[model samples]
Target: MEIKLEEKKIKLVLIILFLGMILPIFLTHQNFKIYDSITKALELWDKEHLLIGMLKLVIMNTLRSIPMYIAIFLLFDSIEIIKNGRKRNFEKVLLILPIIPIAYSLIKIFYDIQLPVGKTSILGVLWFCYYVKFDLKNITYVEKYLVFLSFIVGLQWLDVSRFFNFLGVGEITSDLNKAIIFMEADVIVTLICISFFSFFTLFSILLLHFFKGQEERIARSRSEMENRHLKEVQLLVHDLKTPIFSVGALLETLTLQEEDERKKLYLKKMEDSIEKTNVMISEILSVKSEKPIVIEEMMRFIFSFLSVHKNIEGITYKSYLKKDYKLKGNRILLSRVIINLIVNSWEANSSVVNIMVKDYKKRLIIQIDDCGDGIDIDNINELIKEGVSTKNSSGKGLSFVVKTIKEMEGKIYFVKKIKNGTKIYIILKGDEYGE
Candidate 1:
């Protein structure tokens, strides 16, 4: 399946490049008035100042190629959207599109173009080679820019067209002979420049590729290390369950033996707390499959769990649950998610946390509001990313919540609050499961 997806991506990219390459040819097929005006303007500049004429030529060609650049950008961006099923920032395409025309102009400035090979053809070849070798979408922005710069410099300095033209054995016209003679004196200089730039560009690409590989390797190593640590922690938690089970059994024995009413009530509460701890430990150790659960029942368990286990001093909780709904998900995991959010609010020094649930027939809406040092509105999106946290702790709670919600085909949003607090809204597909 993965290989087939990759093949599809490759075919899409090739089609985009083919269209980009052919677009310039189609646009310049006929001699238009604008082309003639630009050519006459460049001629006028050439007669006055040679340097200015060359600069204008570069700029004019770049301007002419803007349509082709826009086409390529749209094609590439459309392909990305189709393949990834997500919208990307248009600014990224805009940022890279101008580089194509500028690079083509630079090549024209540095190399002498011969007949039978139009400037657009050379541009096509350069684009084809660069994109075929490196996928622009997959690389980092810095790497993309550097690799493109190296590609332009390498092709410009190679002057492959001149070398091929010089080696042609076909009958040459007098004009061609004269052009060869004119460039004859600079043969040695051209050869040296080609050799130096080719080697430099090749080395630069290799060095950059090596550094990219090293970075990927380091990232993979860190991931493996984290996985190993997580396994160790899981094992420790499993070991703790044995002692927890023993404590629950002892509490049960004491609760049954107590004769005093008040003391028996206290002992019963301790037993209940110990049993809840055992259930939590079991949840941590066992993976629960998705099942139909009553939303009201789950909320009741969550509220009771938080009130008993996480009743931090000076912190309060308020719930406004209006209707019952049936949701298809792991009940324990969902409970853990709400419990984690409330605990986070408590840790944030919230005086009060409010949880509101509303039923919308075929959907369920849950809103959690907290009166605490509010979350950074600007970094709300970043907060859900793994290893990202506003507080000084290992940032995994919200990440876990996000993953769990996604698994259940639900959406979570952090809405900006006008007052001194944070508002979180969650939407899930469900049905009314009456009282």
Candidate 2:
């Protein structure tokens, strides 16, 4: 699939080259009448206002260069799309293309003159410079526009009349003497423009390349750091299983020896809690595998886990199970998700935390509500983002929940605008549902 996409992009690049460079040369012919009109316009403007005359010249030249600009922009944009597959704003390209032709037609109708309107290979040198600088470099619209303007302005300073003369398409004017003077002045300006924009293009390319390199380095550093942190966590989880095993063994011994029924029950509950912890730790260390989990059994396990923590002062956990449903997921991981949410509610100073499960239209719904210092409405959205935390801890808990739920093809929503507490809804597909 990737190879096919690359082949398509290569074909597009070839088409753009043919249309932008080769086809233009074959279709366009030198229009001396356009040149005559430009020189006359410049001569008239010079008599009225020299500054405005030069400005008009620059504008006319830029107008003539519009098609080339469009082609260059398209080529640059297409290359970027091919390399990165990220879409860029081509609105400027769209807006400019239609507007230029209409503007040129209006000018021709109003002034009774001809202007260079079609593509030409005359600006081939400038296009080459643009390709060299921008072909592989990612640049902003502002930089593109700036360089485009510079290219237009720089072309005005070139001795184009001399260039035409060299190509055997010399002066159309009857006065050779006037053309000689114009050519001499144009020579000096041409040399200066060439030196200036050449250095400008080179400097811009180098600066952009440097910034791209710095960004890539920063990304690599971040990835390496994350990988190291994950490895450390795996080692810690591996170390934790030994102590948990010892606790489980001790609880088993106590349950076997206890004579009183009440004491035996307490020890049995402890053993069950420790066993769940060991399973959770194992889940963390192993690659994920999903199986059908009966919702009632999962909730019972969660209730047991929460009951063990009920000794904490001023906290109450309530549950409402409307129906039994079967869901497909990692049971230990899913239980941890609920436990994490309940723990968060407790830490929020919540006096009561309610867990409710129901089935709606073949989907399983789990809602958690807490009345402690309910989450601030403003921070609700930020809560699920990795590294953002209201409690200033690692902030991975809710992010983990979100990721796990997504893996199970589930959706989670935080209900803002609630009267006095945080309300969360988790919706997932159910394999089976029963009353």
Candidate 3:
């Protein structure tokens, strides 16, 4: 099965490659007796047979290139996958399955050359790549490291006589073949192992950098999509504005013309509905728009908005307004703050939510008091934080409230807290209260 490569798996593959190279280099340098014995045999080999001598030279050169080729191929591909996610076609590394061992087998027929087990090494890695589907992001580092170690241990030392048979190469099983083959086997294996380790480690570092870079790209893409969606919604909402105004105007004209009280009342309800839609459109537009809102006028809208929820079981509200207060800020933002606080009180099963708008010296104090369970002592300190909501939602309501008030150059405080409920104070400059 073909598996798509992800960042973490690409990293693991690189580490396995480097480890494969490093361990063998260290082992060969320790004067293993096999190396000493292989040294004497290589010197005595038949330099007289021209074809065999040429084949031996070819095998040696090919063997030298194979490790470097594998390292470069795997390293470069892994980096490519990171930069641009999964590929549409097959990976290039699969070419090693047929090519490397077949080339080695040509030498095996005449010289009995000991080729590093390309079959096992490449197959093991490819098998892992296929199995992992290249997505190792969710796994722990320990599990990831263990898999890395297992690939080196299992495939690098794999022994199989049929590796030659699978490629349809005739194995020369004579005493001479065995002697020549086993003579350089240890040294060849050691060199391949060290090469694998050295290259794997070097490329692993490069893969890690690209992997992190891939994550950043994904995040940026997600954010851009969200921004585009927001823009589209705003445009759609803006398109809705004109029709809503026409409907509201039609309702007002009907209300003025109708002589019957019942029909006029119905028209009035329709006007209210259109006004609500208008306010909704205004709210959507005012999200990032800096618009001034009359506090007195906004309070009426808030009262109308809250009246819909007042009939909710156990919720009740009252308002005290001083009249004619104005503030320079986003109306939608101010409306959101009021609605959010009312919602908190409503959801808390408040028996009464008393809203007071007062003129105290040079400040307009809008206070809301709810008769329900008071704010938690511990939570009160963090109550204005985005996530601290009575309904246990995303908790952004109060945070938005605090932010909007700050933008209006205003202040808010939790003035009273008791067994019954809590009171919140919103204070704005008297200068903001225009004629």
lDDT of 2: 0.58
The 10-residue segment with the lowest total lDDT in model 1: 168-177
Write the residue-wise lDDT of candidate 3 on 108-199 in tens digits. 56445444544544554564455345544543454444444444333322321223324222122122235545554534433444455445
> Would you estimate the TM-scores of all the predictions?
0.57, 0.51, 0.40
In the range 1-435, model 1's lDDT, one tens digit per residue, is 011113443455456444544444433413323334334435563322322222333333333444343444334544432223234434334444554545445434544222233333354344534443433444554654455445444543343224434433112222322332443524643565467557757865785677567667777888899778767867988999888889888877887888889998878777777777777667666544566778778877776666555443444444344444477777788888888888887777786888877766566788888888777766655788889987778998899899888877787877657877788888787663544
Each prediction's Cα lDDT score? 0.57, 0.58, 0.56
User: Which order, best to worst by lDDT?
Assistant: 2, 1, 3
Those runs of model 2 whose alpha carbons end farther than 4 Å from true positions after fitting are: 1-221, 311-328, 358-364, 381-389, 392-394, 406-410, 428-435
Question: Model 2, range 110-191, lDDT digits (tens) per residue?
Answer: 5544444332234534344444443334446566556555555555433232334342221222132243354344454345
Q: Which candidate is the best by lDDT?
A: 2
Clashes of each: 0, 1, 12
Q: Which should have the higher TM-score, number 1 or number 3?
A: 1
lDDT of 1 at 42: 50
Ranking by TM-score: 1, 2, 3
| Residue 277 in model 3: lDDT | 76
